[model samples]
Target chain A: MKSKPTACFLLTVVLSCVLVAEGNRDVNQEDRTIEWWTLSTGAGEHDPRTDLNRLIAGEFHEQHPHVNIEITPLHVEDFKKRIQIVVQADSPPDLFQSWGGYVMFEFARQNKLRDITYFVNSTLSKLISRESLAVYSYAGKFYGAPYDMGAVVVWYNRKIFEHAGVPVPQTWQDLLYAVRRIKDAGYVPIAMGGKDRWPAHFWWVYLAMRLGGKEAFDTAYGGTGSFTDPAFIQAGRLFKDLVATGPFQEGFENATYDQQAGLMGDGIAAMELMGQWAPSVAKNNATTGKGLPHLDVFPFPSVEGGKGDINDVMGGGNGYIVGKNAPDETLEFLEYFLSEGVQRRLIEDQGIIPVNKAAARGQTGPIATITGLITKATYYQLYYDQYFPFSVGEALNDASLLLLTGEYTPEETAAAINAAWREFK
Target chain B: MENIKTLYSVKKLGLILLLIGPAFALFTTFVVMPVFQGAYYSLFDWKGIGPLNDFVGVKNFVRLFGHEPFRTAIVNNLKVVLFSLLFQLPTAFFFALLIGRQKFPGAIVFRSFYFFPYVLTEIIAGVIWRFIYNPQFGFLTQLSGLIGPEKTEIAMLGNPETAFNAIFVVIFWKYIGFHMILYIAGLQGVPKDLEDAAVIDGASPLEVIWHVIIPSIRNTIMISVFLSVIGSFNVFDIVWAMGQGGPDHSTETLVTYLYNFGYKRFAFGYGSAVAIVIFFLCLVFNVLYQKYIVGDSRS
Candidate 1:
């Protein structure tokens, strides 16, 4: 009887051991995969992130067989707000789209963004350009990957120009002449949207660049150059002069980006000083057999003796970044994205420019021309508000709009900018 | 006797605790905690997510005094308060008196129509107003065209001279409905015997409303005025959506300016300072209102 009880106990112990082993095996299988969250604006019925998630998931699973990417597309504005909240909550995205500026730099400083120099040196060096990589650099550390270059260029309505008997402007003087002629023909010269202060920033920055070359811009942004400097004041004056031309739509200050683009699409304006992404708008509006106005891109023209040339760039690159908290498997997904084939897919299929050097540049439109300009250029200037300290950038946007709308004189506008900078510093 | 007294006191204590516990916990989490965090953030020169920030004491406030847009934002907030006082409250009171007691044709329908706008979210109302004020396609411009082509380009929300008023019109359209509803409640609460007695004395409708209805609804009037003041001071979403407070910061409110400072420009410290100023201003207004206006109403 004692032996029977002992035998039963032994049997139970062996079975319990096997069950524990089986449970551990299941956990081990689950441990190899990773979860990735991509911040995207889930617009329309079909989310673009869903397609990207599927592509990355397919490749990642095939290669590692142990990784999974979980993509959640938040609204565009919500994405930025969520990052701050989620990071504070101790759970952030694995990878996301990041503008290589103060926002990303702040993340990098906070150690929320991984210093991927170690990984890039070993695996991603040959895949990206040195110039492209430089964009993601801050304080001597490379933080993220450059995904797309948002190079600002002028988008002109060719049919409007042809109708007005004015050719495409090749120089600053030529641009003014074209504007005058277009005005005489009773057509708005430019479709600028001042409703969003950032859009109005383009004119100020362009004029600032024209008046004060790169060195002057560097000096001004560095807190040494005065906004009250003759050059800055002159830029403000130039802005006022442009506004006086009555070249913008009647209610341009109320016009949204869509409205501004719509004006060009409807032949209400002759040209738009915008980024290369404008061709996408053209393509979108070209559905009718009548088609959109013939579209062309150009660089901002030179000032009389200023060193800024027709080829000097006024743009920056947008890039994908891996989170510092991302698991190692997430890095595998980035490697796939940095590949030439995927880069080409982004360009040819999605209209986004790829940062990879090996990506074939076969896609047409403003991306090709912008890439050409980038590759062939000798010098470049970062956009103004991008480089300005936060408070001053707001002041710049406000001052420019206010100046154009007759709220501030040229001198007062310059003083306001300087005062804001003083406060910021 | 001692045991009975102890039991009574204990029961009272427990009841008090039960009554206050939920609200205290909620207030700590939502209000007190955020205020403390904002105060702490104001001390640091943090650009959102960064490693180390320089702690600058009171510099953010000093900076605010010198910044022009901040000044403009304060001025603009004052303008909004003035506008609400001049237009929204009086109009709402007038309509409430005119319509509250009547049984005219479609009176209920008209009351519902007046109340409809208050039901809309601010951004939706802003969009509707945007279309109504649209430069090229809006009915306003179409009507303006009846005058002349030059007048047709009035640029209602885009022109600096009119942008603030355009935003005010939208705010008025939306919130006047709320005030009207409040006034309806107030008017209903007014004693019908007094107004009937005034009419028997040969008082006109306007005279009866001015003397009897006005005094009776004094408490509601006080509440409405105070709410309008706070609402106007904190105006943000409508102004933000409508031309983004632009055509020269003509419509920029303290809240929108704070938002732009913090989110758009990444000056969290400066934004927090602006927020604190707005907070103090609200506190002052509330205190003054309670001390003077509420006391007057009671009297």
Candidate 2:
């Protein structure tokens, strides 16, 4: 009887200890975990994004002490598809990157996006611009935080222009002159990638901005009026003329983005009329040639008879968004991310454009150049396709590809756009 | 006595149900249901999202007919099917017979070499051919340099003229081995005495092959041809990897066009309509093939 009592007493003590240990583990599990999914490109056997993610995670963890952020950086091409698949299935990352306009609009319409209006109104309004917030708004509600913004700007290879003895084109006429001059000098004036359908939208957006002005673009894309305006027709003609000059590399319609980037990087092309994010892509690809230092930007040269001005910016926002179904701790983490310190770190270290205007101007070095551009912008043309309805946007993207490939004449392209708009509406 | 008979019948019925129950359920859930859903979705216009699905009847199919490129994709698919029937299946069968009858040193090694490409994933095969077809840095281009610039400019898969043939070449090289193995298995079933008797009758090698060998493996050839035809029509990876039907979309096949319309363009309704057409075509061809070509053959 004495031995049985002693054994029971020991067993009770062991059980109590086990319960205590389990309780501690539960608390630690809640405290130490964070989850994030990002669309990180260029990840191969040893992706740079992996190291970057680890470093950011390490630093964040060090500051938080009791937190660990789980990061999954997916391949670039697969990013949108994977995210859509996951998020639509009611399982979403704590934080993800989504572009402004229709891309966010679709997610918002599905009620898949978190309304960050309360967050913005309460604490974020003072830091982030209302303009930036307005771009992320859909049906009068903010769906995401602004992370980066860029206008579609022409980036030129200085060496190529200089070798061709063609001056940098300041006006619309000068651009045509440069194109002809560069072509005569035996260097391709422009290296446009038609293989990547998304990139083909450049000519469309540029022409839209040039002909219709920012407001006309906004009205057309917002599904207000007919897209078959004479201005759009004129823009199409200009695009055809540009194509007629044969400024692009031989068989450029078949060339991939990387091939075009390679040509521009090697000084084989005088100019690349693309978005501001192109500088980073160009810089990364630079090897035997001096990269960004030898590169400079300008807004698309003003169409002489067009209403658009030189300062009118054309670009879209690429930024991070929090999930509506994310855990409470994730919201807290996002709050921390929006803090000035983190925003500053993002701009300074990562070269990522911060959504906060304060963060933008305060940033230094290469990021400052982007900041300068943002500060100087008098008007911004949001990426038109993203602002348009899904079907309309898709049709426009198709029309752009068709236009470049000579599958449709300029008039037909304009007609197609209007037809698509009518059908979609 | 009636009870006993009924009990026996019930037991037999139960056994019958038990044998087919799982298989029927599996087919119903996986294949039949999805196909039904696909057919249903084809009638409606939806982005595969939101609460909205607008029923537009056969308008999507009408629109497809109106589109020229889609018609081209269907033609391309037919071309691929024809290429497989005319070239890959026959070539593979002939080689399989030759290898099966011969007794060479390291014959197994030679067979393994032939089957090596068949083991590779489609993506890997595509990448390998893509490298070979590279205009600037490809091995073929380098070899062509030894010949001349005119040959180098052939742009095998890049040019519209040669793209389909180039793709067919890759398909043949990769899948011929699979059919070869099939033929080899069938060749083993051919009675050696029949061939020996033919030889004893003063029949030539070609005659023996024609009268005995060919007839013996008729079933295998039919099956292989059917598989090759289906596979060729369904191919998307090679064309996608090579140039995504570029240089003016000349190389597009049905599957690739369907993928482009559905995924890239987000035209799910039109994409589904395309898929339904492909499905019906495959069904008709399969039925016709089995009835007229395959079932009639006796070996």
Candidate 3:
């Protein structure tokens, strides 16, 4: 009977520890824990990226014995849902994954992010590129930095291109001709994941970027111009012309991003407009698990009679942003995470394009080519869906889907986008 | 000693209140309060955070009604409800009539077999159906390819015209067994004497069924219809896993439309407005259903 009370006391102590696991730093002031959340892209629970991140965190902990890192790796959709709640509550993790545009700006505007401008200017300036860092900047203050970066380009199957007997396209007309030829050769000309919406939206983004360039985007985004501008309409018209050829695989409207990658890997589709992550997804989805027999990328072709520069690029990348309640050690961890040593490993094993300038030298093959394309670009436009406010961006996606389906004319599509833009604050 | 009966009744009432207190509190806190809170939040243009200062009354509703996708969602939901009543449940009733007789061989076996679809989770069913509907390598596509002349390709969920109906078929399959089982249970209560009386009175199987078994199982049918109507309004998982209400929102239902355009877009105010509309829809439905259709049975 005496032992019963003692047992209850011990149980209470254990329960308290369990409850305070997430509340560790709150109770003990001396213990600084950096809660880092990153999105795990693959289906597997044990993502290599997360494993590498844990290793890096271990190293960091060794260096700073006073600090600890609690890593929470979530899937893409789960991360999006969780981040919104946490940031809105103003009790976000110390460091979390960020795509670094409208959403980041929204968070920064709400004073949820730590103003790490000084850290960037003093330490990270020498490590990462200006373009990658600029995305995290809201009203002249840096909040984050990217570890991996790449531009959106047409990833094509070289063997399929060889079979179709088409040279690399340099102009809009040339791309159209190549697409027709490829389709006639009994292969899907352009593999589009219409169900996902973003994959189909990229065509419109590239076309708009090619036609209107920075001037059109800036004028429209700044509210000096409107989405119903002739440039946007023209972009829609060109995309419609591409749609006329029925270049996508049968039932493209329901095809998810994974299916698009699968087609390319299975050697059924000629090309796809995708980011650097496309190849990895294709490899996993491939029948043989080796992916495409011969894979290559070329810059999106220039549109004739357009104001845009031919070398202009449109893309975005993965990065991290700090919460307002982040510890000082969070900056140090960011620095180490984006350092040359770690980044080189990322490039070598994961086939990631590093944002670190020193680590860029290690990139070879298609990744190296992408780095070159991005570097020589006179203009780099972020993906419109990410760059614009949440609702307006989603409107663009919805409009783009309608455009590709040929349900709406170019004028109608542009009008739809403008309507949504008008409603946005 | 002066009021013993009253004192005992008061004690019993006190005991009842004490027993019901915790459950009542929980129900009000979680369910009732959220409904009222959602109504209040529906008025403001709140983004799930920051100040609730943006007071935009009735504007969210106006926009929601005018929205094209929301209209599609409403129509799709109505189709689901209509199909459930006119077709799915009727078919289930027919099957129940066939198997409800204990004398029918393999009656339990058929019931178990029919109920198998309901055993699978909504998401698992969706994923399995997605594989069967794949345009390139799907089972249906391959089977059609063997029969058709032009190397037949059928993208059931891929086509906007067919996607909703295609998913509806899967949903119909999933729920048919449930209603059939409900009817079967109701049939057990239907005394054999009345059925025998109808047969002796020169009534055919159809007429006898209409007069006798149908009247006896009226309560079960009402409950089944009510469940089906509510389920149609709230259908999300299968549709979501299948297409996420895509192919231009062709397969969109009310709840899916809310998730896609509301929460996913971070328009919490709009989402709240959607919730309000759905609440009123369900509430009105429940009230009308209880009062008009099955009120007598309750009384």
TM-score of chain B of each: 0.93, 0.92, 0.96
Which segments of candidate 1 are over 4 A away from where they belong? A1-39, A85-93, A118-125, A210-212, A221-234, A281-293, A325-332, A408-425, B36-57, B149-151, B296-299
DockQ of 1: 0.51
Model 3: DockQ score: 0.51
lDDT (Cα, tens digit) per residue for candidate 2, span B1-299: 99999999999999999999999999999988987778888898877665446889999899988877787788888888888788887788787876866798877887999899999888789878876776545777788788884544335664566777787788889998999999999999999999999999999999998999888888888888888878877888877876676545677888888886666666777788888888888898899998899768732
CAPRI-style grade of the A/B interface in model 2 = incorrect
Q: Pick the winner on TM-score between candidates 2 and 3.
A: 3
Looking at model 1, give its docking quality level: medium
Cα distance off (Å), candidate 1, residue A408: 4.1
TM-score to native of every candidate shown? 0.88, 0.84, 0.93
Compared with the true structure, what per-residue lDDT tens digits does model 3 show for residues B55-84?
999999999999889999999999999999
Two-chain DockQ for each candidate model: 0.51, 0.21, 0.51
Off-target runs (Cα >4 Å) in candidate 3 are A1-31, A42-45, B102-104
Q: Between the candidate structures 1 and 3, which one is better when assessed by DockQ? A: 1
Q: Is 1 or 3 the stronger prediction by lDDT?
A: 3
Cα lDDT of model 1 by residue, B1-299, tens digit: 99999999999999998999899999999998988788888877776754436899998889778867678889888988898889889999888877876778887887889989989888888888898898877877788778675556658898877888888888888999899889989988888899889999999988997899889998888889999999988998888878776777666788988887766777777678888888889999999998888877567
